[model samples]
Target chain A: MTTERVDDATTLTDDERRTLAAIADRLIPAAHGMPSAADVVTDERLRFALNARPDLAEPLRQALRPELGPDLQARLDTLGADEPATLYALQLVIVGAYYTDAGVRDGIGYPGQVAITVRSWEYPQYLEDGLIDAVLARGPVWRDPATGTRARTDNAPNTYAERFGGTPPEGDTHGHDRA
Target chain B: MASEPADVLIIGAGASGAVVALRLAEAGFKVTCLEQGEWLNRADYPGNKLDWELKARKDWATSPNIRGLASDYPIVEDDTPVSPLMYNAVGGSTIIFAGAWPRALPSDFRVRSLDGIADDWPIDYFELLPYFYRTDKQFGISGLPGDPAYPPDTEDAPMPPLPIGAAGLKVARGMTKLGWHWWPEFNSINSTNYDGRRPCVQRSTCQSGCNEGAKASTDLTHWPKAIGLGATLITGARVSRIEHNDKALATGATWIDRDGAEHFQPAKVVVLAANAIGTPRLLLLSGLGNSSGLVGKRLMMHPFANVAGLFEEPLMSWAGQFGDLIESLEFYETDEKRGFVRGARWGLAPTGGPINTALPSRAGEQAWGPDHHLHVRSHLGHGANWGLFAEDLPDEANHITLSDTVTDASGIPAPEVHYRMSDNSRRMLDFHIERAKESMDAAGAYKIEVDRLMRYSGWHLLGTARMGDDPKTSVVDRWNRSHDVKNLYVVDGSCFVTSSGVNPTSTIVAIALRAADHMVETRFEQQVPA
Candidate 1:
């Protein structure tokens, strides 16, 4: 099956495009509701990278030559296993492009970029409300150097401990008390 | 070639050059700044664009070795593991820096006296304190007061620290658990609308240049002010060498413009604020400032590494400002038992954006295909990376010299950086790696990945033309005035006597301010001995 071209800036031939797509697919296979690299137009990203750094294109072209065989998977497997710098560069662009997709980012549960809109410069209320205390209660935690084996001494009213409350959970301090 | 005489001609329009220009011009001296790169406005900055990360990897890369723009000169960095990274622009490296604005510890000034390792700075922290305060106020620094890590001082940041994200909070708790001192990190970014600049909106791409002008890059903070105060800034003017008179004092500098036209700007005083590598290269080319035979010796790039901790919960590592929101200098002072003379400071950093995280590991680990997707899905948001900035001692072997073979677009010889991690640095890295792992473990991270061999981490380039009281041992004196060339001054990181473990921009600006103050007081009106 052929894919629609997303970018026309490349001088890559149809065979070269197919070879690149096959390699990209092998690099980032479809998984977890996310489209495979080839389906999501990663080839365009690869083409752009190749155009920018022309030195990478020849090695890729050589590695994916049809004379290397009709077996596309075998060609990709051989290329991947050989660990050429060209393969790494291709893999980088493929993966980078895949994640940059908004759909892919949402599918993977990443919030992407965010802007702080609150006008005031105060600390986030959640931190002061109870988050610090909750984290501290995950003890017996890493030992504070100033406090030694005991808990911190300067746990004032608005401090990490007092803000979240000073009660340790019953039984062992969970498995997180590594220190 | 326009041949107007200015009272002062600064070679670079970067960090120190901008500061000096502002101060000298404000003192009624005619100052002309010659910058090799173009003056970029907010529109020129890479804003919240979708391809911002690509911009960093391509056009706006911090290293000239990587970017190779026509405006940038090439450098031979193959000899050094950590490449000297900088941006050639009105603001220099600050245009691409993360703006982690930590001051050098007081002891950093007296390393030779206290630790008996590197030479002591000709000036001390106490002497530079007022300038530091001035710089902090100027930059509108954001930080929490009463950080137990620092020695008690009256100086407080202008604003509260940037909001500590979950990753920073987690790391702070981890440090607390490990019995270490951690505090809200000071940043050269405005937390609120200060002066005429807008507050930081947490764009998360400060390294790509702040389009909002929230970060205190000199172009945003000082250049416009200097220009308003009657300073002449000629961009695209690449200085080839400082021209000296028979009296051995610099009269002016000859530079090549963008059209390859050479112009000589005459000045009563010439200041070299062209960064560590650029300044020394020009001085050597001019055949001056080598009376001590130490023009480009004793280079230091603060050796650093990154440790990433993977957690089960999402911490949104890619969404906030890149500054170190939380940091620990508990190990910043000297500790003889660790088999090292000095220590390091580790700060909380994000695991980078999607593209950066998806890029293959520098250690040859493939982050591609189904395995790559699964790995990123499991770790991206859950990862918190720590940057460890360790002090690199001034070793004469680790130096920058003029390359005999390579030349830049200006037909000037490129800088050849020769550097290797000293034994002390290696030991410090090993120690810091272990400590970082412990901190991660304490933070309840299931897995920790440490890139101990950081090959691309040398952003803080320093100590090419060191300052001292003795002319036999140094290039410039305490006032940053060249010992050999009386009217010529070397300001910027090149005059740094020691490379502190923290970021050096704050210290660099403070030093420049102090030097400019001295120049205005004593020599602003002096004429060149024609």
Candidate 2:
């Protein structure tokens, strides 16, 4: 499937196409029932992107030249770490194209843009309610003042003082964190 | 060729220009508005398409240079730390704005007396309050009242505030723990169907133009009102130069039409609402309002940053309006001990779409291969982002000048912006980043990331031709009338004496209303200022 010649406006040589497919696969490899970038027709997307931004195609092709051998992942890792712009160019086309696929969105548990029904505004009670109690329970995340220790308190009006003890850092109220 | 004379001519049908046009037209004046870009219908918005996110990254991009639309003029931004981002449409940058409507604080106007750093505004906040209320009603602003962060006398928003989603709930709880003041954000978007426009359907694509006509861009509010009131609005009419008589009063302007034909419009009064960079560019090009040699000086771009958190639970931040709903202005005023004069407003933001999140982080941290897929999948609905709109003080060195080498399609010299974040701004950003991270941590975020400096978000362009009583130090007076060229006025962000610690759209519109009222009361059907 990866070897198939995808027809596009900007004609990429066979080697360029294969190299891009290999790079796309490495960038977003198929695993855990989710398809890889190549499986989501990234080659066709890249061709279209290249046709639109022709200036980026040559740099991408040049970036792939040194890594044209069997150890494609190693070269790609080096390129990704070393040449960021080239890697970003490749990743932008692949990731952007891959996410557009419905199967990929479903596989990744991304419920795409949902239509919102506008209604009268209401104060969301979930904040007062214990909807995020599980996360809050792992608290005492804020630091203490005199004790120099992290402490947690129930989400109450005077929670900051009850938890931290000894007056919160004055100045910018937020400066307490830096202190 | 010369055209028929009008009672009033306004340049750029943007936030300020549109309001001025509507108000003047309502005052029975023959008003003509020239806009550089065409009117974009709600149907033309990319939010209606499946590839909406893709369009946001390309054709409908916020940066004119990146979008490269025929309507966009080039900007040379090599010297600036952040590139200027704007849209050249009937509604201008408001088309891409997040509808974050925050008025400048009363202290913001008295910065010189309060902070002793920036100069004071010629007109104080009280003078602009009525206009604010009027424009808020027009925009159908939705917000909560009695936010302890603002001054006690602050008026309540017209419409009820938008719902604070799960992510906002987390942040609110976190702020409560930290004892920080947080409130529902004031939005220009309609909470319920009001003024013939639909309510925000929470598409989370406010930056890509609102498809539902919920977001109050001028095209939906002022433009239609102005047109209904018999105002002549010519789209695709780029004003090249402001024409003036021997006495140095503004006659009108010379503009280039869509077909590249030249036109000279003569008006009794001319208003330049062509934004900060644009207004200065025209003034300098035509040699209109440079008597004080400060036409394009003191450019300010609100330096900003974002702090993101990965939560254990599904926050589903991508479901609602992206940058609306909640904000914290606890740190809005100045604090001498914090090492910065003006502070920033922390607002809730989404983690963006799938592709944008999957891309390498600002610090160049890439989550790749099988591990990348797993990482992204796990973080899909479990992320929230908060942003800071920090104040960048006006500096004469940081300004807009005409680039001798760069010219746009119309052969007009492109604006070359030269700006660098001041030490004060850097200190403010550092504090903001720390506070944002602390809030995220308090929200139970296991993995936290901060883009210490937002280099690509130059949304608020202000203070080029600022308002001041001193003509030697300012371009316009208290009424937004150019001191050097009397009948000529500047009603945009260009007239902002100081860039406040918030979005300037609401204030921009309000200032325009106030300026128009002044014009009608004092100068309507009267002789041009001599």
Candidate 3:
């Protein structure tokens, strides 16, 4: 797995870096053609939102420690091991990154599962751009903080429609993932 | 602090407080308005999805600086059996609402009279109509005039109805075929042009916040006008307590800023428009609610669930306003056939983005994973969904109280919301879902997925600090003034006697405008300015 550094304001240590990757992978395990958890979880936008909520990070870290081992442990050690706030932020970013990723689009089983079939609609194009940015921009993190969790760099729906074509429709009829 | 003592002091710049302030201010008393949320501009609303959804790049520092004087509006394990309460900046809940504005039917105001259950509002639709017309004009609502499914129009909408998509058109046609009384729902959004405000661009992001001034949030309408009229809006200021004199009349208010400093604003009249949950919680926290003991009681929410369908062709769900082109009230009337008094309203809505798309269901679902990947290879693009917004009965047992267990940023107990649906509401929901399924089938849905009743889902909270004739029975009088505290007033959904089946923002604005007129004519001038 090719490791890319997460460009948070401060450069995370090697251990911190490994833990982020592991956490992201666990949140979204790559079992299909979408993309690897490692490839999609690196977005910088996703990392920042995780930092905002420290409480959610602890549960994430607790869930991942046994699976990730030393790389994850060293990151914890670097933060002096007791920083619940730090872990909470990291986990939120990891979960958020995993869920919204195009790979998870099929994994989460969104309706009509078809990717962009609408070649000319006004909105699909932006969704296509967002999908490309999500896939190619690599760190799964939101670039702009003001948009909070929904922030993305490609900010245009046309960009997404142009790139990915359309969302793939799900064959299953039970599409409840709406929060 | 002001130079002289006054009768009431209003806190927070939002839907509820703005209405209360306008009411008392119009009544001829000196009224002061306090807003903790930032005063944003039209430009502040960027037309970007990320910017709209996550509020990305919106200045967290410059945003509403109001801290929860009391933290976390908590939902107790016992009281709020299902949902959570969300806190927002200016405009209160109206800021984040989809602007699916609708008026309450005549029966909604007189629940006790028509249904023979629950208490009746001290006032009714007739009392609110003129004000409704005023606010609809001020807010610039849009719809086809006089659809007849609702009350007759007193004034035409500012803009024409938004164009209905294939799905909406299909639903409308199907409803018409079924002889159902269907019309485009009225909303406080500009479909064309109104009073210098632009119309909606069909961006479908109203729930996130309208970047365009089309949606009628208090921040865009009343609060801005109030500020222009010399109302001092202090953003990020969370009011902690309502200071009173020896006579127990409200004199001023104390709030905490983000920086943890306590600030005080002295006003003659105190209006609480923090919304259904916030208004009551704040009044309780201020120690001004016990006289009536109805500070945080009788909280109600219009519980909404959804039913989604997939057609052979694409519905292009995201092509319009968040919710406008579709409206249904097949189950709106009260009847024993449905085993409920009040009814539910259903609408066809576009699905939210991926993160919000998660739902609870049985197996064979393939939206995610390898099967979903394969499914996407065939069916992914065309999607349309329907929403079920049902009226929940007012259970005095459903309420908001201060929780001893949890606290927010400022160390006050979070408002604990204990809400349980009355059996009548459940029966109404079941009947409505069956009707919704029929509509979907009529619209030619090849495959459909409906949701269970989400009793606690919507944050459209109301009726806790209610308006009634008797102080013993309610928190405020018909004019939305507190019966117990002569000078104190409660606006917002909290003052709602019944949680109407429709969105409450338009009604909230109507009540506020009415109250403003009342205040200007009767109350404000009597107070000697300090």
TM-scores of the models, in the given order?
A: 0.89, 0.88, 0.76
Colliding pairs, model 2: A140-A151, A140-A152
lDDT of 2 by residue, B266-341 (tens): 8989999889989999999999887778888889889988888888888887767764658877677777899878
Reference-based lDDT, residue B216, model 3? 75
What C-alpha lDDT, on a 0 to 100 scale, does residue B404 get in candidate 3?
A: 82
User: Predictions ranked by TM-score, top down?
Assistant: 1, 2, 3
Task: For residues B1-530, write the lDDT of model 3, one tens digit per residue.
Answer: 33343344666676667665554444444556666555555555433333222232122111122112222233444555446434456675566567777787666776667667787777777778888887777777766553434444456665556555666666665665565545556677765555666666666666556767777777766665665554555667777777777676776788777677887777666777777767777788888855677777877787777676666776556556665667776567666666677777776666544433321121224243334333433333345566776777777778777888776566667677677777777777777777777777877777677666654355577888878888778778887777766667676778888887887777877887776566666653433233
Greater DockQ among 1 and 3 belongs to: 1
Give the runs in model 2 whose Cα sits over 4 Å from its true position.
Answer: A1-7, A42-86, A121-123, A126-179, B152-155, B524-526
For lDDT, the strongest prediction is 2
Mind giving the per-residue lDDT tens digits that candidate 1 earns over B233-324? 98988999899899988889999987788999998899999989999999999999899988888898999888888889888877566777
- Give the per-residue lDDT digits (tens) of candidate 1, residues A1-179: 01223244355678877876777787677876668888875556665554444444566566656776767667656767775665655565566556667787788886555667423333354345554444334332122323222223243234454532443211111233312
Query: Order of all candidates by lDDT, from best down to worst?
Result: 2, 1, 3
Q: lDDT of each model, Cα atoms only? A: 0.77, 0.78, 0.59
On the 0 to 100 scale, the lDDT of residue B229 in model 3 is 50
DockQ of each: 0.17, 0.19, 0.05
* Model 3 spans with C-alpha error above 4 angstroms: A1-63, A68-179, B1-8, B20-30, B40-47, B50-78, B289-292, B355-366, B374-381, B524-530
